[model samples]
Target: MTVNGRRVPVLSAEGVTVRIGGRVLLDAVDLDVHAGEVLALVGPNGAGKSTLLGVIAGDTQPDRGRTVLDGTDLRRWRLGDLARRRALLTQANSVAFPFTVREVVAMGRAPWASLPEGDDDEAIIEESLAATDTTHLHSRTFPTLSGGEKARASLSRALAQRAGVLLLDEPTAAVDLRHQEIVLELARTVADGGGAVVVVLHDLELAAAWSDRLVMISDGRIRAAGPPHQVLTAELVEEVYRQPVLVHRHPVTGDLLVTPDRRGSRPTRTPVAPAAGAALDSAFVKEFS
Candidate 1:
C-alpha cells in the first residue's frame, strides 16, 4: 500500500469523523496502525477512544471520511476477506448462547473454512487457548464463566483467527494484574510475529510500557501522538485529562510512569489548635452525654 510513493499503514482512519445526536464522537482523527508495532489509543472517559476504535474495527461508520485497511477502503472489501485480514475484540465479550469455550474459539476459523488450512482448525484452536491461558476452561460454557475468565476466552477466540491486524478494546479490562501482563505480552508477541496490533487502554502505565507509540485523544480530537516519553508529558496529562499528574521514568525498567500528582490536586489537612477544636469538642461531649 502506497500514497505518492510512501508506504501506507496496515490500517488507518483518513480524516474520520463521527457524530451522533448533535454530539461529535470522533473529530477528523487521522491515525495509523502499522505492522510489527502495538499502538495504544488512550483518553479520558467519553473522550472518544472507544468510538475511534469502533471506526477502525468497521463496527461504527464515521459520519465523514473512511477507514482504510491495507490501502483499500474497508467498505470495498468482502466481509469474509476482511475478517481474515483483521480481527476485532470488543470490550463486551458476551455470548448469547451456551457455547463451550472450545466451540467459541473455533468460530474464528469460519473465515478460513474454504482455505487449505481449514482441516487444521482444531490445532489452531488449541494453540490459541494455550496462548491466552484459557485451555483449562475449554470444557466450560462461556456464559458460566466469570468476567475475567470470559475475557481470556474471548481473547483466545480472536487469537485463533490469526489475522494480520488486531484491534483490541481493553483486552485486559476484566483480568487480574498477572493476566493483564499476559494479555499485553500476547499483543507484543503478535506484533513480533509481523502483525499490527491496535489496543485501547485505560492503564496509562501499561500503554506506555507495551506500545510502540501512543495516541492520546481528548474531546474527540488527538491531543498527542508519539513515543511515550514525548507524548505523555506532565503538561499533556494535566491539560487533556484535566488532572495534575507526574510523568517520570521508572527506576527499575526505565519505562515512563504516570502517577497522579496528589499534592497538586488537593491541599493536605493540618492539625487544628486545641483552642480551635474547643467548640467541636464541646459539641461532641454534649452529644454523647
Candidate 2:
C-alpha cells in the first residue's frame, strides 16, 4: 500500500540548485511533498527556504536539476494544467486594479474554466472565503485592506484554487496571534484531507507544532530534516542558527517549544497547572470551534 514505507510524493525536487547573479541561492537541494502531510520549511532570513519553494511551485526553474509533479517533470505540464494541480501564495499579493476581494478570489477559478469543475465555482468560493475568515471582506476593494486583511484575502484566493498541492510562503507573516493559529490550522486541514502542503515559517515553534515534518535550511543547503521531535533539538537549533535557544516540551500540550535563552536577563516563575484554566478554555472552544 506504500512506496518504500511512504506514499509516492505528489511533488518532488531532485538535485535542485539555483544561482542568481553568480550567487548560489540553493545547492543540490532535494525535497519531497507527500499527500496527507504538512511540511514546514524553516530557517533564518535569506536561507533559501523561499527559493526552494519557488522551485517546487514551478515559478523558478532549477539551474541544475528537475522538479516533478505527480511523477512527471514540471516543465511538461501546460500552464493551466499546472495551475489546477497546485496553488502558490507569495509574500505579497497585489492587484494593479481595484478589484473587489470577491473578484480576486474568483480569479483562482480560472484554471478550471470551460471544464466541468467550473460548475462548482460559486460554492467553492464561498467555502474558501469562510475558511480564511474573509467572507465579510468580499465586497471590499483589495487595495484598501490592511496588512492582515490582505494576507487573509490572498489565502482565500489560493484556497479557492482547490489545488492538490499548496505552497505558502510566510502565510502567517502579517497575521495576529489568533490568525496565525487559524492559518496553520487551515494548512493542517488541507493535509488531513489528502492534499500536500508546504509552508515556509519563521516561527520555529509554530512550524514544529503544525508540521508533520520540518526541513531546516541554511546557507543554501538543508541542515536538518525530519519529524519535529527528531529535528528540533536545542543543539541543532543553536548550531544552525548560531543563536542560543532553549528547546523543551509545552507544559500542557507536550508539543515542542523553542525559545531564546536571553542569557538569564528575565525572572523565572512557576507555571500554573493546566486544571486552573480548563473552564475558560472550554468556554472559548465551545463558543468558537
lDDT of 1 at 83: 89
Compared with the true structure, what per-residue lDDT tens digits does model 2 show for residues 58-155? Answer: 99999999999999999999999999999999998888999999999999999999999999999999999999899999999999999999999999
True-structure Cα RMSD, model 1? 4.0
TM-score computed on alpha carbons, candidate 1: 0.90
lDDT of 1 by residue, 255-275 (tens): 889999988556787988998
Candidate 2 runs further than 4 Å off: 1-6, 264-289
Compute the lDDT of residue 280 as modeled in candidate 2: 71
Ten-residue segment with the worst summed lDDT in candidate 1?
263-272
At residue 114, give the lDDT of candidate 1: 79
Estimate every model's Cα lDDT from 0 to 1: 0.92, 0.94
Could you tell me how far off, in angstroms, the CA of residue 179 lies in candidate 2 after the best superposition?
Answer: 1.0
